[model samples]
Target: MLKAVSLGPGDLSLLTPAARWAVEEAEVVAGYKGYIELIPDEVLEGKIVVSTGMMGEVDRARQAVEHARAGRKTVMVCSGDAGIYAMAGLLMEVLESEGLLKTVPFEVVPGVAAFNAAAALLGAPLMHDFASISLSDLLTPWERIEQRLQAAASADFVIALYNPRSRKRSDHLREALGIIGRYRRPSTPVGMVRKAYRAGQFVEAVPLKAVDVDKVDMQTVLIVGNSATRLVEGRMLTPRGYHRKYAL
Candidate 1:
């Protein structure tokens, strides 16, 4: 059996029990090196670890599938929910390509995603409709991402941005903010959480115009408010319109 487990943003406490059980019961564990490092030492003490650096996702997935086919209980771990910008789909693709999709037993153990963790830290900014977009253009085209941002902004949906910035794509986030700026006011609320629930965690709420782009990186999750969103006290909030029908 193969299990794709989510570690939930490098914080063990946020990792779901099912995900931890998948990892603990596996004889072989395969994942990106960074995410593998986040697993508790005790849980990984007796497991055969397969780890690789950046751009090695396909190799890792292939190895996990092969290990599972060999009758070893194998698990692939990824930070946040595995289905969200993680290894679940890639593993499925590899399994199908290997012709073991039907024969192999597989399961996905979901956990708290970055946006979920970020939203909790930033208060209820996603109380209404929202869109999640990744600024990374490695696999996705920039044109399509820009179109999504434009649509999400124009539709007045709260926006959650993932992979907001990286060394090579330094300008993407700023450019996205620019596109959104055309639809949102300069004073619109924007909240950023870096390394949420993990070491060096940082959370800030500021106006869209005052965002410090240089401070953002791949570890940061940015939540841009909708037209009706606001900063209440220190929290970023978006109303659900229940007030329209209720008396207080």
Candidate 2:
């Protein structure tokens, strides 16, 4: 059997029970090296761990499927929920293409995604309607990302940005800021959380125009508030109809 387990951002405490169980029972585990490093030593003490660097998703998926086919319980790990910008879809596609979709029994174990973890650290910035967009154009076109950014900004939806920047993709975040600037005010609330729930975790909120794009990287999650959002007592918040409905 093959299990796709979500490691939940970077904290072992955030791992769901099902995910923990999958890891505990798996004979083989495969994941990006960074995520593999986050797993507790005891959980992986006797397990066959296959660690790969970035952009190794296809190879990792193939290895996991091969292990499962050999009658071993294999688990592929990912940070955050497996379904969101993670390995679940890629693994499924690989399995289907290899004619093992039905032959291999598999399951997906869910975990708290980065957006949700970052939101908790930044107060309630996502209390209202929101959209999550990835800035990385490696697998997606920059034009499509720009279109989505424009639509989300124009609609006044709170935006959660993933894969905001990288060494080779430095200019994308600046371009995204420009697209968002078209519809949002200069003083709009923006919160950035890096390495959430992990070592060297940092969370801060700054005005939209003052956001330090240079400080944001692939490990960070950025939240841009909607027009209705505000910073109260140093906390980013978007009221969820409580003022009108509850008279608070």
Global Cα lDDT for candidate 1: 0.92
Leading candidate by TM-score = 1
lDDT by residue (25-117, candidate 1, tens digit) is 899999999899998789899899999997899999999999999999999999889989889999999999989988899999988999999
TM-score of 1: 0.97
Over 4 Å off, model 2: none
lDDT of 2 by residue, 1-248 (tens): 99889989877789888998999999999999998988889999999999999978899999988898889999999999987999998888888988998999978888899999999999999989999999988889999999999999999999999999876869888999899999999989999999889889999988998999888878889999999889877679998854586654
| Residue clash pairs of candidate 2 | none
Which segments of model 1 are wrong by more than 4 Å?
Answer: none
Backbone collisions counted per model = 0, 0
**Predictions in order: lDDT:** 0.92, 0.91
In model 1, what lDDT does residue 97 have?
Answer: 94
